[model samples]
Target: METPRERWVGADAGPIVRPYAVTRGRTRPRGMDVDLVTLLVATGRTPGERVWLSREQRRLLELCRHPSTPADLASDTDLPLRVVQILLADLHQYGLVEEVPQAEPAGRSTGRPDPKILMRVLDELRRL
Candidate 1:
């Protein structure tokens, strides 16, 4: 049988550190809502001396210099989506990052669709 070290010694070996280790074994972001389309931007506040940031966290901050979505951040850093969300939540808690409010689409006033339009669509579906 091949030793574990020998088995993982080649270029084919996967990531050295697992995602759980990076997030300290936390599977979810704390008290923060994050979704694929949710926009995130840096708050322009620098981390204080007391703040301890991991390499991944620093990389996230750099990527958030401009408005970014969690999906984009994950893709850019080549990290898992959950890991990015957790790191972003930490930055958000520190006030180093903020969520950007999405604007309503142009030519739309209310969030709810018109009842009449919905009824018509339903009627069409029923006909089908």
Candidate 2:
């Protein structure tokens, strides 16, 4: 039998709040498309005193002060990628963060990769 103090605070103890709890039982982001490479930047707007924010969410905002990707944020926070995406979506809804649009190459109207580059990659792979 473990004492209350030992059970509550121990070297082997896990996080007090589980990942699902942090995300409010949500596995996917709502109304936002967040990918691993999606760039996110803080909107420089502070949350009001009336607004509530979780510890993880605050930390995420701090990390996003400098534009960062979901993958980078996940690695920095040591959280799962899905959790980071959900958090980002929440921040976006709150107007605390926004996605930075990636610039397109010149003369490339469509987002698809160039076929010549694909052919070159295939040839290189076949040679290996």
Q: Poorest 10 consecutive residues of model 2 by lDDT?
A: 8-17
Instruction: Give TM per candidate.
Output: 0.75, 0.76
The local lDDT score (0 to 100) that residue 24 gets in candidate 1 is 97
For candidate 2, the lDDT comes to: 0.90
Alpha-carbon runs more than 4 Å astray in model 2: 2-16, 112-128
Q: Which predicted model would earn the best TM-score? A: 2
Q: What shift in Å separates residue 5 of candidate 2 from its native position after superposition?
A: 6.1
- Report lDDT (Cα) of residue 52, candidate 1: 95
- Clash number by candidate, in order: 0, 0
Error of 2 at 63 (Å): 0.6
